[model samples]
Target: MNVESIRLINFRNYNSLNINLNKRINIFIGKNAQGKTNLLESIYMCATGRSFRTNRDKEIINFNKNEAYIGAMINIDNYEKFIEIKMERDKNKRIRVNKTELKNYKELYSGLNVVIFSPEDLKLVKGGPQERRSFLDMGISQIKPVYKYNINRYSKILFQRNNLLKSNKSKSEIFSLLDIFDVQMAKIGTDIIIERAKFIEGLSDICKNIHNITTLNNEDLTLEYISNVQLLKNKTNMEKEYLNKLKMNFSKDLEIGTTEIGPHRDDIIMYINNRDVKTYGSQGQQRTVVLSIKLSEVELIKKERGVYPVLLLDDVFSELDEERRKYLTRSFNEMQTIITATDVIDLEELQNVERSIFYIEEGKLII
Candidate 1:
């Protein structure tokens, strides 16, 4: 699957822009703060219905405009698809495919799959557990729409349960709500934990190989899903354990006025030579880990989705050394990639291949 073209209006700095894309290795070259990353963000929004940089959708609209529009022409399995999204201030966004409005936005997840790698991804290793959980949830949601539904349900239950706690309602009221929420949370959370364990297992296989290649076989890299509840071994055991912990922590949660446990609190750990990379690994090692995980994500998506997802590299070439950059470029040669960089010099080697150059300047694309 690949994006054939993209159209943007009132999106961030891009007042209006449209450009065709090369099926392989399309490069967006411009200086810093010239809307290079914004271009990739628009593509990401088209694919995922959300922004990677900000949770507020209104932030994507132009300062002078109250709404933003993004549309894409996608080619998947020899079929062409048209996807368009309309964002309005103080209102929910609208999405359409092939002139038909989507009844449920989740339906948009069927064909379009995108994998984004950016400088910010390095934080996946060093950042808090929320970032890692988000990585797993977002990837899984795209592959399984049911996960999206369950997540939404789980979040809603968590919100209501927390609100009840905050109100300092009667003990009976709290117990009733907690009972309902726990049952649903365990049901959905168990599914998520199980799937994540499987994903991490698959990722380990690919990451081990990629890490060996990236590090020249000098480092042994491993990924483990760190969970307070051991869900993978026995589903019922973990669910019961999590439920008991939630009950045990009820008083503390009430004092803090927050939901303290479940999949939201789980995380994935990366190790290099049996040492935690987040705290002990050098910057370069962290980059290698990020690269390995992303490549693993690509393979995982392909294996599960049965087609390669579009690869979006946002100024990532500038983050790697020459040897590593070469390895990354060579590895993705067969996949459709849209890369943003400050200059074309780093990518001159691919000029002879099937590629196109778009010069972006202050929200404008020079064809």
Candidate 2:
């Protein structure tokens, strides 16, 4: 899939803008804080109905504005699709496809696919477990809408169970609800674990090679899916294990006023030469690992969807070296990529051809 054009209004620094994009490579050049990242975020929001920078939808609207709007025309397998997103401060967000309002969010995930790489992605390896879990959840949600539904349902159930615990409810009363929640959580959580395991397994194959190329074959990388509970080992024993763990942690969870154990707490561990990369790996190694994961995401999405997902690189070129930059440029020849950077010299040196270059200053795009 490729984005043909994008329209933004009252989104971050962009007041009002509309621009057509090249299917191959479109570059946005601007200095820092000049709305370069905002442009890429707008395209990501249009594709996923979520922002990569912030979680609160209200923050996405320009200051003093009650709402923000983003629209895009995407081409998937030679078919054109129009996607529109409206974000309001006090109301639920709205999404429309081909001008038809969607009744459910799952309806929006059918055709649109995008993979975003930004400087912050380095956090996937060095940051806390939440970041890694979020990475898995977001990718899975895009490819499998059912995972979205199950996640929402499991989260709701977990919330209610936590509330019950904090209310000083009787053990018998809470236990019943916990049993139901545990059963459901294990079922959904196991599915998530299974899918993530498979994804990481597939990703390792590509990441290893990519990391070797990026590091001049000096370092070896590995990705391992780490979970609080081992559910993949025995499907028949999963329910029992889930129930026992919840029971054992009941008092602790009640004291904390939260659900403490489950897939929500899972994480991915990155190792280089059998050592934890987050703590021991150099900055260059961390960056290369992130790049490998992202490129692997592009390949995985293409394999599953039968089309390449649109690639969005937000100000990441400045952080890469010349050799790595060339490697990234060579990797994008088979996919559609939109990159934002402060200058075009590096990009110009990497590839030679007809490309769309937009100059972003303040909130204006000078074509």
Candidate 3:
């Protein structure tokens, strides 16, 4: 998959812009706050139908404008698709692939495939469980569009169930209503947990080898999916396990006024040589862990989709040493990569690689 071109209007600091991208390597260089990362965010928005930087869509619009637009022409499996998004300050953003508008963001997941790595992604190892869960969900949703629907439905059910727990209804009435929520949550949550488990299982295997290579085979890496429900080798009965857990946790959940056990509370534990990377790993080890996972994501997408997703790098080289920087740039030849950097990268790293460079200042591009 490749993004052939992108046009932005009133997106972040860009008032108006249009650019064609090289298929191999396209680098955007600029000082901080000059709309470099904003360019990548626009392509990502087209790929996943959401901004990677923020949850509120309105924040991406220009301060002087009430609306913003992003249009991109992408090629996937040898066919060209036009993705159009219209964001209004007060309403839901509208999306269209070709001329047909998507009914929901879930439908847009398969429209474009992209794997993004930014400075913030280090949070996957150093941050809370939500970040890790998001990494799993976003990575899976690209290849499995229905996974997005399951996530949305599960989240809605979780929200309603939590509200019901906090309501002023009698214990008997609340328990009666919870039975229905419990069954639905179990079935949907089971789907989520099962998929997550399988994804982490596959991603773990791929990340292991990549991490080894990046670390010169000096350290080992592994990932395990942690769920409240005890998953078995045979997942045919996982739904039952999840339902029983939810029912068993009811009194505790009632006391806390919230649902406490499900996929929403799941996490991925990263281990380096049998040691918890989050707590025991040094800064370099943590960075290596995240790098391995991201490279593994690109491989997994290619494995599942039969095409490499567009790789977006947001000023990540500055965070790495010369060795790790070379390790990352070496892979740029394998797929279409767009990078944002505040300064020029090492010329030696770009040797023999086909590339295009664009400079940005105050939302304007100079090629």
Candidate 4:
């Protein structure tokens, strides 16, 4: 999949702008705060129906404008289609594909599958488990849109259950309600756990190879889902196991005012030669693991979707060492990539094929 062009109106720093893009690799070069990341965010929002940088859609709108608009021409399976998304103040965002409104926003998931790597992604290994979980969810959702529904539904159920646990009512008054929440949670949580396991399972081999090549074969990388469901093996029925676990933890959860066990409480463990990266690996090892995982995302998506997902690199390559940068650049040959950096990268070092570089200044894109 590739983005053919993108137009932005009142999006972040861009009041109104439009630009065509390169199918192979398009690089946005500018100093910080010059709207480098903003352009990439526009493409991402168009693809995912949400923002990776912020939760509030209004934050994406320019202060002088009441609404933000993003339009793009996407190329998939030898055909091109247009998609538009507009978010207005105090209103729900509107999305249209080929000018037809969709009742289901989830259609955007398959419309544009993207793998993004911002500088913050460097923290994937050293950061909290939440970051790792977010990485897993984004990659998985592209292939399985139902995974998106399950996660959203699971989150809502978790919030309601937590609220009940913290309510003023006596424990006896809400015990039955908690049971209902557990049933729903188990049903949806099982889907989430199963999907997550499948994703990691698909990603494991590619990630290992990436880590080995980047680290000169000195380290063997590994990934595992550290789920709360102790009997997570496929042999056991997940929903039933989940209900039993929740029941076993009811007293503790009631005391803590939160649901205790499920995907929300799960994590991913990364290892190098059987050594935990978070605790034993050095800074370089940790960053390498994250990079390998990000690149592996591109392959995993291609394997599942039969099309390479657009790659968004937010000043991440500039921070890498020369060897690492070259290695990552080599992968760009096979995919559509949008990258942001302060200085323009030399395409000669990575590609002899077509590439487009846009210089950003004061929110304007000049090719």
- State each model's CA lDDT, in order: 0.85, 0.82, 0.90, 0.86
* Model 4: pairs clashing at backbone N, Cα or C within 3 Å: none
Candidate maximizing lDDT: 3
Among these predicted structures, which one has the highest TM-score?
3
Off by over 4 Å in 4: 103-107, 231-236
Better of 1 and 2 by TM-score: 1
TM-score of 2: 0.94
In angstroms, give how far residue 71 of model 2 lies from its true place.
Answer: 1.2
Error at 267, model 2, angstroms: 0.8
Off by over 4 Å in 1: 103-107, 232-234, 347-351
Residue 121 lDDT, candidate 2, scale 0-100: 93
Total clashing pairs for each candidate:
0, 0, 0, 0
TM-score: the better of candidates 2 and 3: 3
lDDT (Cα, tens digit) per residue for candidate 3, span 313-337: 9999998888788888888888999
lDDT of 1 at 320: 92
TM-score versus the correct structure, for each prediction: 0.95, 0.94, 0.97, 0.95
User: For candidate 2, lDDT tens digit of each residue in 242-337?
Assistant: 767888888788778888778888888898888899989899888988998898888888888888888899888888888888888886768788
Alpha-carbon RMSD of each model:
1.7, 1.8, 1.2, 1.8
Of the pair 1 and 3, which is ahead by lDDT? 3
